[model samples]
Target: MSTAQPDEGTDRATPDALLHTRTGTEVTPEDVVLAAGRDVTPKNLEWAKRKIETEGVAALDKLLP
Candidate 1:
């Protein structure tokens, strides 16, 4: 039996972007609280703000990586 391989140089079609996609990379306090599995209450938001201020970039890096 013989088999054929796909063309390596062929260009594949890229999928269209979602209709309601977020365009910004800006991370908000809500993102932190939500990522930590906590409710988005006023106190939690305040804590997130302080965490961001103290940790600086580490806050987002910790959540993502």
Candidate 2:
């Protein structure tokens, strides 16, 4: 992720633009939080990173809508 900040009205660093910088086919942790109408926190980002490392990216689909 870049050193940029989330746009106004957000509570975390990972904004949708930064979150979607990678392949558009995958849903990032930030996207998950946005889907739930919440802000992405450090803990959430950590959890998502951990899950991806432990279970692989495909495992993330289970947490998506």
Q: In order, what lDDT does every prediction score?
A: 0.72, 0.61
Give the lDDT of residue 25 in candidate 2.
Answer: 74
Summarize candidate 1's per-residue lDDT along 1-65 as a digit string, tens digits.
88988899667665543332223566678877876789999999998899888986457557652
Q: lDDT for model 2, please.
A: 0.61
Sliding window of 10 residues with minimal summed lDDT for model 2: 15-24
Steric clash pairs (candidate 1): none
Instruction: Name the best candidate (by lDDT).
Output: 1
| TM-score (all chains, Cα) for each model | 0.55, 0.42
Error of 2 at 49 (Å): 0.5
lDDT of 2 by residue, 3-63 (tens): 9877888875675445533355775677555544556898877776676667665545555
